[model samples]
Target: MPLNEEEAVLLGAAWQRLAGGGPEAAAVGAELLDRWNEPHRRYHTLLHLWETLRAVDVLQGEAADADGVRYAVWFHDAVYEGRPGRDEEESAELAARLLELVGEEPARIGEVVRLVGVTATHRPEEWDADGKVVSDADLSVLAGPTDEYLAYTAAIRAEYRHIPDRVFRAGRSRVLRSLLDGPHVFHTAFGRAHWEARARVNMLAELDRLASSAPLDLPPP
Candidate 1:
């Protein structure tokens, strides 16, 4: 699908936030692709960004934001690894810098930063708009059908490069099971109403595959 108007504004805002405005398409496109190329970071790649941006659109449905959700997307996985607080801290820092450069209100920028943190690890009992949406966007991939989900898993495995397959499998199975057995894969009505069944089904199939140990049947790494 083509970039929707709200998505465009959000993209423009991220570009403006990042480079202080008036950035050419080539530059931003290159930056987006560059970020995509970082090995093993594929789960949070530009495609994921594009997909989540679209998912958020599906959720919000043509609303423009005084929101920092756009900004949150840009920084949500900014530091997925190595930096424990990168998503929150760097996202906040980027928001602050963007606000300073783009002339947004300092107070709004702070809230945007706070919103980003709220999304870090969603806690159901403590839900808010940003937290809910951010969490939904991040989990949207699970809602995808088979091939895409496998591709996502491969990308995630790539991210943890040093870990051996045996070790990785053990860890991967645990996480997959956690999602499969969870109460809900997505929190919001829009997503739950739409993507939940598909996600759970896919997750269970993958889990079953992981639980098997027939030497002749297990696929090669």
Candidate 2:
């Protein structure tokens, strides 16, 4: 879906802040927005980008380089294709190229690339403030209200509609199990305090549903 006027304004302001307000920067932002709106996407759409950005704003003070975190958020899923590791690697590469196009410093571009890579595992070192913030913000959807969380899972199912229900359930259940087995679902202190428990509850409930005999009420592909 095309960005609404409010989303456009907000994203434009954010792009200006991070990329220093140039035509090249604007072009790059437009390109990323286009990718986010691609028809193949269901969950990883512009709406997800907007939500991540908003979550970042809530945890901005926790970032060592807040602008870098924002840049990472913009590019983290810029090339999502349902392939987790390769998608992140390509997205990091995309971030590097576009940030360089907009005359971002080499070091800053490198940081953005690294931050984008961190999203692959969501397992940044405890001392990595920017990584923690980016990971937590990207995952904030997991902690949303019950209805919103169900919608998120349904959208995810839609995205992988090519996979059979049994296969998708097994794979998704494994992913959820790994997350639940982790020390914390969210990395940052704010996330741990505010989002961790709810995210766990949501994931556990989804795991139950996935394991049950009843079919999911997911949107048709």
Candidate 3:
């Protein structure tokens, strides 16, 4: 799908902020908008990118490199081919290439690229404050109110529509369990204060729902 009006506006704004108004930055934004508008996308669409950037802006005070975080937020899902780590890797590579084209400093471009891939695990070295900020912002949706969270779940299910229900539930349950088992779902202190409790509640509720569903062995059609 082509980028919608609101999405195009958001992309333009992000590019203007990052690129400081130029054709090269506009081209980079267009490339990212194309990926976010890909027909197969659901939850990882421009809406997600827009919301994530908003969240980052809200948390910018805590970031060691707000610029890098913003750049990463724009391109983190730029190559969502449905493979987890591979998708992040490819997105990071794209970020590097595009940032270089726009004449971003080598160090800043490296940081942006690293941040894009860092999302694959949502974990960073203890000293990586920027990584924590981006990770927490990316996952802020999990802690959103019930209605919004439900919508996010629906969108994600639609994105993976090809997967069988039973298989999807099992895989999703595992992902939720991993987060629940972790010491912290949102690494930053502000994130913990704002989202940790609610995220846990939501994840546990969803996991319970999955557990109660009937088992099936049929393959995806």
Candidate 4:
């Protein structure tokens, strides 16, 4: 179903707020593309946003508030300057303005903005189901089929193009290892059941490529 009027309004308001901040987030999909994804030529920019929303739709209660989800989408990558702290604060500030425009009750809007800040953590230890669902959606790209996974590897690498091959490889390997070594590849049953195993397979394949210095094909192993 197309997003209803309410959702469309809220989403547009949220996006407007993001654009007003002067980064032109919608132009090429937030800083995730320019600073990281573009630098690394990673495919996680708009495509990631699109797929995550699709996942959210299939999930029950997963939409929470389309506005809330929209807020998360804008702010999730808000903090991608290859540095930390700033993204969350900047996103929170933008959210504050958007909340004002949305005519959200001052208190509730503040709370929603804060939740957007929460996403800076990417994976919270404990949280509301809505936040978790959205977060899982953001990370779900990692859990896709092998070919999709390899594409992500390139995206991430493009983001870090300034780093030498050795440094980037080591760091990237560590990230993949951490995910692979984790007790759960995904936080929610939906993502775990649906995408975790394949994610692992793809991650391991990337790891192997790093270790062997071999050209990786789509989907690694």
Best by lDDT: 2
Task: Compute each candidate's TM-score over C-alphas.
Answer: 0.72, 0.96, 0.92, 0.69
> lDDT tens string, model 3, 118-158?
89998877899999999999999999898788777877777
Best by TM-score: 2
Tens digit per residue, CA lDDT, model 4, 1-221: 12355754554454555444443445423433333233322443445555665666665354456556655565555445454458667767766765565455676566667666655555645556666676677777777776656667776666666678787789878777866776776767687788878777887878888888664332211
Candidate 1 on 1-221: residue-level lDDT in tens? 23467865566565555445454534544454455446546466666777776677676642235246665666566545634456557756655665555565777677667766755554434436656676677788887878878777666766665666677678778777766666876777787899889988887887776667622122223
> If the candidates were sorted by their lDDT against the true structure, best first, what order would they fall in?
2, 3, 1, 4
Ranking by TM-score: 2, 3, 1, 4
How far residue 168's Cα lies from its native spot in candidate 2, in Å, is 0.4
Name every residue pair that clashes in candidate 1. Answer: none
Write down the RMSD of all candidates, one decimal each.
5.3, 1.3, 3.3, 6.9
- What are the per-residue Cα lDDT tens digits for candidate 2 across 1-221? 34688987887787787787778988998899889889999999988998899999999999999989999999999999999899999999999899899998999999999999999989899889999999999999999999999999999999899899999999999989988999999998899999999999999999999999898767866
Residue 206, candidate 1: alpha-carbon lDDT: 73
Over 4 Å off, model 1: 1-40, 61-66, 82-89, 124-127, 180-182, 213-221
Query: For model 2, what is the error of residue 52's alpha carbon versus the real structure, in angstroms, after optimal superposition?
Result: 0.4
Error of 2 at 24 (Å): 0.8
Evaluation by lDDT, superior candidate among 1 and 4: 1
Off by over 4 Å in 3: 1-10, 214-221
